[model samples]
Target: MGLEFNDETFRGDYTFRNSAKAIARFPFPFAEDSYMYSVNMEPHLPGRPGSVFEHMFDVDEHYVAEMRDRAQVLAEDPLRCQSLPHMTLAGWDLLELIMESKARDYPQWFSLTKDGNRWHWINRPLQIEQSFTFLDETTLPYGPMEYITRQTQGDFTLQDQRDDNLWIEAGMVTTQADWSLDFDIGMSFHEWHAPVPLAHEMRVFDRALKFLLNLQLGAPVRRFNWTMTVDPLLDTSPENYPKWGPSKTTMTPETIGHRQHLRVELQTLHRLPRSNAIVFPIRCYLIKFEELVTVPKWARRLHRVVRDIPDELATYKGFIRNKPLMLDYLSKYDDGAPTSPGIWPE
Candidate 1:
């Protein structure tokens, strides 16, 4: 659960997964289909650290791509940026609140200021500074929010310290805008090689709060996440979904491109338990919004008698191969629960 990955990382190493019980609750705890996300770990260059970035669902690929292009463009010409276009992205309100408190409670370590909703950081006398803005939930399809993360060390030599060129895995998420009990959860290991992740990875309070933040909103956004540790209990199995929707999905590298997209979702839980400094930009898309139908009132009470609970395998705490915990949990709630015949997806 505490391992790390670089550019040469494996697919099975850093993707989202859950325990047997977790998958059994698909469309509830996990999405039934594979979420299309472009996992960009930054440019794999020498003396440069790669980062993991995701863009799920079709938000606006053109805009997301442009913001990243411009940020890198402006980095070279801070002065000339005035003549060109520069966008001030949103989503920094939470950071300003913490930075302000830090300035008062821990003045020496943290210094924060807010110009309107814009927040900046200066830990030293060097040109080392950071800034971020708050972005509201979007209902319209527009370009991605833009921001930059840089690590500059002038004559500084600290292996562990983040002292290098600025790097950003820029991206965005789309609005789901559906009327289903659907949600998205993503969890990843925050790369240990980066220092930015220390803010959340090393702090239990921050990680726990992040969990609540994504829940408040319908789906989980990766920008608020870090690198996730590969937990053995985590669900990372083959994709399975009911094919009753008008829009189906074709998942492939060429089709999904840098991003992996999936449709026909009921509910989702995209989580991030990152141990490194990374950002995952996730978006939920509901191709079709239908009636929030439920069966007879008493139908919801048929779970206990219909579903069977398997005996404890090795340790109830964890799971063994092919253990049917998912089935157990599903059965536990089938008192009169609705059942979808296996052939329905056809």
Candidate 2:
């Protein structure tokens, strides 16, 4: 049986504080009249003037709550976080990079100190303070990747550039949007994204690998990808399909807006200073459909994109089942009247 869609009040408790600000700062996936997958990479300018490039790692109001979610997910399924043997040093590289970045950005809440090979990290928000050797896993409760992921809000993956390509060397990914880190482990760049439509036909993945390999130490690249979900869930991995799969069939015209949500992944890829591993961090944000139309611009743009989106992309995103209903709900705001049946795709 599918999950029942009740007439429930949508609460965006998991999102960052201030919806207007969140929407304003939101990395809307579509840029122009159409949407397609591509190797969209931008420089890692932390303090850039634009809304998107302002930060590489975001530490926001939901920091505590999000970290708690990650802990719970890891507790239930340890496979949610995995690091291959060779990537151990890369894990340490990521931990130090994240610690330094967070401490520098939020000096009041986060601090890091180094004494020779030993280092201490202080996370005021979580009341956590620990000291560990740079590449020593014994000093921490778990492996370097898992230990670092436990403290941060992003799902991280460390990809090593070798054999003239990038390989999934190690990663600690707890809040996977739809993909599986365990399944993707050891898969090459092209093999990992094999499911994506048009990526290979257009050579997007190969081109992206070349671009990533050439990235300098200080330069990082970022992109946005989006889909719709029925609830605010961080562990929407395929293993938990029984929990969220029923959501699509249960949705109705009345419950669509309140029950359905727009989930977007704000992803950043950077070159690790020491190990030369490419660290990819992904942060997901969820906004209710009912709340989305409140921002007239977002609602209008989303409607246009959904309506114009190709069937292949729509099917891949799981939008085929409920696209018509979502479109009708958005159409109510586009015009005073609901969308006509004729306007909907077959």
lDDT of 1 by residue, 191-252 (tens): 32222322344464345344533332223333211111112111121111121121123322
Using all chains and alpha carbons, the TM-scores for the candidates as numbered come to 0.20, 0.88
Pick out the ten consecutive residues of candidate 2 with the lowest summed lDDT. Answer: 1-10
RMSD per model, one decimal = 20.7, 6.9
Residue pairs in candidate 2 whose N, alpha carbon or C atoms collide under 3 angstroms: 2-246
Error of 2 at 65 (Å): 1.3
Regions more than 4 Å wrong, model 2: 1-20, 47-52, 335-346
Q: What TM-score number comes out for model 2?
A: 0.88
lDDT of 2 by residue, 273-299 (tens): 788889999887777787777766566
Q: Highest lDDT, which number?
A: 2
Off by over 4 Å in 1: 1-145, 148-346
